[model samples]
Target: MSDTAPADWDPRSPKVLDNQIQAYDEMRHRCPVAYSDYLLWSLFRHEDVMRALTDHETFSNGASRHLSIPNAMDPPEHTPYRRIVEKYFTQEHIDEFEPVCRANTEALFDDLPPEGDIEVMSALAQPFAVRNQCAFMGWPDSLREPLRQWIGKNHRATRAGDRQAMSKIALEFDGYISEQLILRREAGEEAPPDATTRLLHEKVEGRWLSDEEIVSIIRNWTVGELGTIAASVGILIHYLAAHPELQEALRQGHENLPEAIDEILRIHAPLISNRRITTRAVTIGGREIPAGERLSVIWASANRDEDVFGDPDEFQPQRNRDNNLLYGAGLHVCPGAPLARLELQVFMETLLAKVRHIELSPDTTPERAQFPASGFASLPVRVQRG
Candidate 1:
């Protein structure tokens, strides 16, 4: 066992959680490699984070105790499962889902007041994310409310570090997914042709995937689709609201919505951090970490590192596109990036095409989400009909 180092910082402190982006930026410079009880070691610099991401063997992703499909598995085991997951997010799949994603965005936009104050999280972001995921997975409309509630519970359990609560929440999610699997199984040949049904027939290692494995895969996808996508919407909308010129430029079609969206998200990361476990003793950012140590690559900090992107908050989509770790990098890079890009592009395009202007509510304040989550908890905005 390696000697325990003095605590470098507290990740769960109220001050840190209050404004995570700023705190992480400070950490990247003050203590690029920090140690905390909650997150053993956090790599905050872009270069250090890239090292961990690329050298998957040294910084393994199998950090979770629970089965996490390919997300928590190393190569050999991760390869085949990853291949199956990739099939669902292909260019062809995204193309087919584009119209459905647009319809979902339009329906939500139509429900918004013509020209008045609205809370984007509840009124727009959350619903758009939940509805799109349901449509993509062929889940029923009824699952929307439950899934939204589940996301809240999951975040709470994680923040509290209550394993029992986390396990219960995981089982609750599994139950919901298993029900979908059961219905498709009962329908047999009459089952609807959808992503969920397609998963029921996927094979890995020359055998049909077990119910547990299938549920794990679907759970991973659902969590990513629901939480990150919703957070991303709020971040994108909030940034545009604060920058009228950029908003108008995007609206006038002078800027590429997709590139702008990616750049904005990098400035304010939707997903804060992801975990890894050191396979052996490794020195990163001049800090010595021993084998079996858990590490967190803070995407929020790394993407904003000054060395990589001078003036981290500068709006330079094309100039910074190459190094942006918005969807991540390396073997465990998000497989759903194509679908996410398509959904965000469609949502932004529809919003710009339909709304003349989006501005923050003058009387209300936007609440930032605490750790374990990023983006606005509540974002009140005023919209003008196009």
Candidate 2:
């Protein structure tokens, strides 16, 4: 809506709601490379996203997307931090998390009434995921509720650009992580040898990570795992319930749950946008862009590009057989992807193992999260428990 928009760019309509994925579909088709006065360059096409993600030199992650994490850094510099962070989420660690993750999910599911309407998001998906995250990080139970609230608040405030509230919550979280770091140090242990320790003790640039850096790393991991995993659970459940055949396939163990999970993640990513910035002049989508300008990779739109995916809007488990940017692409792809996969699989398996059927409540619809996370905030449903 500003003078900075390219001549060919069509601004995303002002009326677009956070929960609507169709709005993103139109943006992908109509303005794959749109410009916004506030959000800057937005890349929607599948190829564009691939190019931007792969070409690290031209699109530096160090700019943090002005966001955070390996998502915000470039190569070399990003490598060290990512290396230490990756070690924390190794296959062994994830395998170790399964029992804990299952316990958390099962605990919440047990609380659900056998035959009554319930908000699955609040009762199960979200808190279950957040508790597992806290358990994995070795954070005390005292921090769980506040951390959950902070995760939701930060996502909302960041998107709305409410810096004051965002900063307040962020600082409080930082302080909490810092305190945990100190406690871990005093104990001469790294939070019971989980992600916190792996990150705290790993060397970066031949030196140990500073407490602040440790806090930052933990900050990224918490939001990444907790928020999106919860959202994905709700979205996946809603989809599966609405499509009984798929649900039956998963339950009967006659179909591919992994592929089904991938398809769902590809179809309905939780985060609305990831911020990236141009580090140098580059031509993309028939236009030349200068450096230092912010760009957002529209994962939701890219996932739905018709050019890359056939019947993109529809959920087909085997779609994009080889390449799907669902967990993202290249080096900056989610480090905890393995952990996320395990959690998602466990959620599907555990739910299917326990509940015989899932039915959405009549006259009620699952609502998508507003602002930062795009998946469901609450999905009300009735399940016939085993």
Give candidate 2 regions above 4 Å deviation.
1-3, 6-14, 65-67, 189-191
Please estimate how well model 2 matches the true structure, expressed as its whole-model Cα lDDT: 0.78
Which 10 consecutive residues of model 1 have the lowest summed lDDT?
1-10
lDDT of 1 by residue, 122-201 (tens): 99999999999999999999999999999989998999999999999999999999999999999999999999999989
TM-score of 1: 0.99
How do the residues 1-386 of candidate 2 rate in per-residue lDDT, one tens digit apiece? 23565544333344456445777788777777877665678898989999988888888666552346565677776777787778777888888888998888788778777766778888878787778888888888888788878888887787677878877888888988888877877878424775675666677778887776777778888888888888888888888878898899888888888998988778877666777778778889976678787788888888878888878857677757456777888878888889888888988888898888888988688776765677887789888888
Superposing every Cα of model 1 onto the true structure, what RMSD results?
Answer: 0.8
lDDT of each: 0.94, 0.78
Score every model by TM-score. Answer: 0.99, 0.93
